[model samples]
Structures are given as C-alpha cells and as structure tokens.
Target: MRLGIIGVGHLASALVKGVLRTGFLTAENIVLAPRGHSAQLRAQFGCTIAEDNAGLVNACDTVLLAVRPQDAVAAVSGLPWRSDQIVLSACAGVSIADLAPYVQAAQVVRIMPTIAAQFGESATLVYPALPQLAPLLAALGKSYELKSEDHFEVGSVSAAIFGWAQALIGASSDWSSDKGMDRAQARALIAQTFISAGTMVAKTDEPVSQLLDSLATPGGITEAGLKHLENTAAIEAWNGAADAALGKLEKRR
Candidate 1:
C-alpha cells in the first residue's frame, strides 16, 4: 500500500526508511509532500513527493501524520481525506477527539512510538479500535490495544516524558570528564554500557532481582554499586520521572 507521510522530519524519515528497507513499499508507491523537507525525503526514500497536502492525501491509501504536537490540529484540519483512506497519527499528547472534527475518515489509529523506529526497534504502543488496521500497527512494535483512553494517555506520557535518558547521560559524561576520560571514550563507554544492559534485559526471562543477586554475589563490587545507586535515590527518581510524564500527558487533553 502506498504510505503518504505529512511531515518529512526525523521520525517520518525513519518510517519511510523502515518501510522501504523492510520491503513494505516501493519507490513508485510512496508519496511525500509539499513541505520544506520534501526534497530531502524524496532523496532519502527515492519516492515521489507531493506538491501539496491535498496531493499527499490523494496519492496514498494510508496516511501517517508525523508532525509535532503543536502543528497537529492545524495540519490535520487542513487535509481532505477520502473515506477509503486509513489515518495513523504519531503526534503525542493529542487525542483522537482533537482530530475528529477535522477529517471524515472511517479508521484512525493512535500510535505512540519512539525514534528507535528508525532501526525497526521502536517501542510502539497502539490503541486501535478498528481490527483491520491492527496488523499494520503490530508491524511497528509490540502493539497494545488499550482498554481505555486513560491508559493510552499513560503510554503517551511514557513515550514523550522518557527523555530523561539525556539527563542521565549528561550527568555521567561530566563525571567521566572529572575522571580524566576524554569525551569520545566517555560517550562510547556510556553508550556501550546502556546497549549491553538493554540487551541483557531483552534476552533474559529471569527476574531482575535474581539476575542482580547473581551479579552482586553477596558483597561484590556490583552489590556495592547497587547499594550506592539505591542509597542515592537514582531508581526511585527515575520512577518519579515516568509518573510525572504520565501526569503531564493526562492533563494535555
């Protein structure tokens, strides 16, 4: 199916790349748009670029709205969609109700995805009321059809508010600088540790407590570090971040 993207930004570019890289669409099938970055997307994805928003809607069967939250209402309100078209929105903190007045399309899927989608490893959460579009969302990530709009808001918060990883990384780089480690090596080590830890979590079915116990060995360096982390309130603070993020999303709409 032809996938027409409204915005040719980073996440949209990733979706375009992933679809083509994974053989979901052909160069002739995908259509981008009248926006400023259309040339870049056309170059990156080798697809035809539309000259206007109406042209984008008319060109494709499925439409992905990837613009920022601030621009969502005005952008979608401006689109003219056919009844046959399927709309999938990636704007965070914006509700289905927010777009309902703008378009007359039958099926609309609300999605929460991170930039990992560029590499096909995005943690995408879906709340699709229509079953026909269910498979399409599942292709993005492990999809979850939330029972209520409240939970979707919760996931939306988690998706947008989880950027504190940047804060953690920034703090660690400073510490490494103090230790005489150059910026490059410090950044590489930080990245490698995060990747390794994430891989460990993904591959194992073991309870994290059990895994940590094995590493700690009842007084080892891992245990010492773990104790220090707990005492310093790092883990608790991270939970606070997620909670705060959820609260913000719930208030937005």
Candidate 2:
C-alpha cells in the first residue's frame, strides 16, 4: 500500500525505516511530508518529499499522522484529506474524537510504537482493533488491537517505559565501566541481558514473582541485589515515573 507520513520525526522515521527494511512498502511507494529531519530522511530512504500536508495526503491511500499531540489538530485541520484514506495517528494521547474533525477520514486508528520499530521489534498498539491495519502494524512489530481509546492511552503510557529502559541499561553500563570493564563490552553485555530478559518474559507464562523466586534463592547474589534495590526504592521510583507519564497522557483529550 502507498503510504504518506506527516511529521518526519525520530519515531516516524523509525517506522518508515522498519517498514522498508521488512519490504512491507518500497521507497517509491512512500511519500513524506517535510518537517523535522525530513531532508535527512528523504536522502536516506529515497522516499518522495511532499511540499505540504495536503500534497502528501493526496499522494497516498494511507496517511500516518505523527505530529506531536499539541500540533496534531492544527496540522491535520489544514490538510485536505480524502474520505477513503485510512488515517493512522501516532500522536500521543490524541484520541479519535480529537482527530476526527480535523482529518475527516472514514477510518481513523490511533497507534503507539517505540524506537524498537526501527528494527521491526516494537510492540505496536492500535486502537479500535481494525482488522485491515493489522498486517501493516504487525510488519513493524507485535501488533495489539485495543478495544477502546482508553486502552490505547494506557498502552501509550506503557510504551513510554522503553525510554526508561534504555536509561536503565545505560546506567548499568556506566556502573560496569566504572569498575574497569571495557565500556563497549559493558554496553553490549547489558543490551544482551535486556534482550534475554524480554525473551524470557515473553516466552514464559509464569508469574513474575515466581520467576523472581527461582532466581532470588536465600543468601544468593540475586537475593542480595533484590534487597539492595528494594532498600534503595528503585522499584518505587520506576512506578512513580510511570505514574507521571500516565498523568500527562491522561490530561490530553
């Protein structure tokens, strides 16, 4: 399917790269509306650059609205959208009701994807769970069709954890390097650890507490770290970060 992307920011750029990498869409079939880092994207992906939003929408059947939440209304309102186009929005916290008046499309889907999308590993969340968009979303990563806008908002908050996860890995790597480990090796090892953890969590149906119990044997090193982490309030701090992110998303329409 021909794709048109408005707002060529980092996340949208990752989606474009992932789709192309997976051969879901060819460069010739995609057009990007110029915005932040658009020139670099056009050069890197060999995709067409539309002079304006209307131009972009006019050139494709599917349009991805990737503008920031605050800019979504204005950006889409100014565009001349076709009634047949499937408008999939990646703007955080912006619901279908907030976007419908501006887009005026027959189909609108809200989506949330992480930076992992660049490698086709993102957990993409779609609202209203339209079957038509499933294949395309799945091409980018794991596709979840949420039943309601409320569910999509919750998914967005969850997706924000990817950023925090990267930070945690970086912090771990820094600690390792400070103890005389090679910085590059430390980063690679920490990345592998995260990858392995994710794989285990995804593959196992066991409760996390049960999994932790398996690792945190009495007087073991895992138990020691768990105690230290609990004493340091690490888990509570992460929960607080999630709450803060949800608070911002909840404030949006």
Candidate 3:
C-alpha cells in the first residue's frame, strides 16, 4: 500500500525504517511530509518527499499521522482526504472523534507504537482494528486491538511503561556494573532477563500471579526482593504512575 506520513519525527522515522526493513512497503511507495526528519529519510531511503501535507495526503491511500498531540488536529486539517483513505494516528491522547471533523471522509484510527518498531519488536496498540492495516502493523511487531476507545486509552499507558522499563533496565545494569560485573555483560544480561520474563508471561496460559508464585518460591532470592518491593510499596507506586498517565490522557480528550 502507498503510505503517507504527515509527521516525520523520531517515532515516524523508526516506523519508516521498520516497514522498509520488512519490505512491507518500498521506499518508492512511501510519501513523507516535508518537516522534521523527512529530508533525512528521503535521502537515506529514496522515499518520496511531498511538497507539503496536502501533497502527501493526495499521493497515498493510507496516511500515518505522527505529529505532537497538540499539533495533530492542525496537521490533518484541510488535507485532501478521500473516502477510501485510512489515517493511522500515533498521537498520544488524541481520539478519533477529535480528528473526525478535520479528516473528512477518511477513517481515523488511533495507534500507539514505540521506538522498538525500529527492530520490528514494537507492541503496537490499535483501536477499532482495520483488517487492511494488519500486515503493516504486524511488520513492526505484535499488535493488540483494544475493544473500545476507553480501553485504548488505558492501553496507551504502555507507551510510557516502555520507557520506564528501559529506565529500570539501565539502572539495574548500572547496579550490576557497580558490583563488579562487566559493563557490557551487565547491560546485556539485564535487558535479556526482561525479555525472557515478558516472553514467559506472553507465551504461557497460566495466570501471571501463578507464574510469579512459582518463581518467587518461599525463602528464595526472588521472594526476598518481592518482600522488599512490597514493603516499599513499589507496586502501589507503579500503579499510581500509571493512574497519573491515564489522568493526563483523559484530560486531553
């Protein structure tokens, strides 16, 4: 499919790399809006660079909107949207309803994909799943479709969680290094540990709590750490952070 990208920022750039790497779309088939990293991408990938947003919209049947949350509406407004066009928006906290009036005759779908898309590992989130976009989404990584906009908003919090996970990994790696582990080894070990943990939960049918219970056996190292985290209310704090993110998203609507 011919895809147009309105906001060619970091995340959008990663997605461009992802789709191209997977051969989901060719550089010639992609159209990029003129701002942000568009020029760099065009030079590097031989992708088409549109004269303007209008030109980009006119050239492609499916458009990926990746502008800032506040700039999303303005960027899409007055575009030459067609009845068969699909607009996949990655702007956090912006709802399809908010773009409906501006993107006339076009289908606006909300999507949240992380920078991991660059490695074809993004756990992309989609609302009101469109069958036509499945292959594109799958090329980046696993895609989860939320049942409704409300659930999509809740799922959007995973975007922030992704960064938090990275931060935790970094901190853990540093701690390991401080304790005399090789820096590179520590980083790799910590990162892979996280991947393994996530893979276990994702690939198994057993409840998460049960899996954790098995790992955190009585009097074990895992149990000791779990006790400490619980005593320090780490889980509660994590929930509070997620709640705060959800609150901000709700306010954006």
The top-ranked prediction according to lDDT is 3
Error of 3 at 75 (Å): 0.3
lDDT of 1 by residue, 1-253 (tens): 7888887787777667656666656778888876756788777667898878888887888888888878887887767788888778888777888887787864577888776665666677777656766545544555667777778887776565436665666678778978999988888788677778778887999988887778787768988888999999979987887888777676768
lDDT of predicted model 3: 0.95
Highest TM-score scorer: 3
C-alpha positional error of residue 241 in candidate 1 after TM-score superposition, expressed in Å: 1.7
Could you tell me which residue pairs clash in candidate 3?
A: none
lDDT tens digits, residues 104-132, model 2? Answer: 76478888988788898999888877777
What is candidate 2's TM-score against the reference? 0.96
Relative to the true structure, how large is the alpha-carbon lDDT of every model? 0.75, 0.86, 0.95
Per-residue accuracy of model 3 over 1-253 as CA lDDT, tens digit each: 9999999999999999999999989999999998999889988999999999998888999999999999999999998899999999999999999999999999999999999998999999998899999999998999999999999999999999999999999999999999999999999999999999999999999999999999998999999999999999999999999999999999999
Off by more than 4 A, model 3: none
The list of candidate 1 runs beyond 4 A from truth reads 129-145
From the highest TM-score down, the ranking of the candidates is 3, 2, 1
Where does candidate 1 have its weakest 10-residue lDDT segment? 134-143
> Model 3 residue 174 lDDT?
100
RMSD to the native, candidate 3? Answer: 0.8
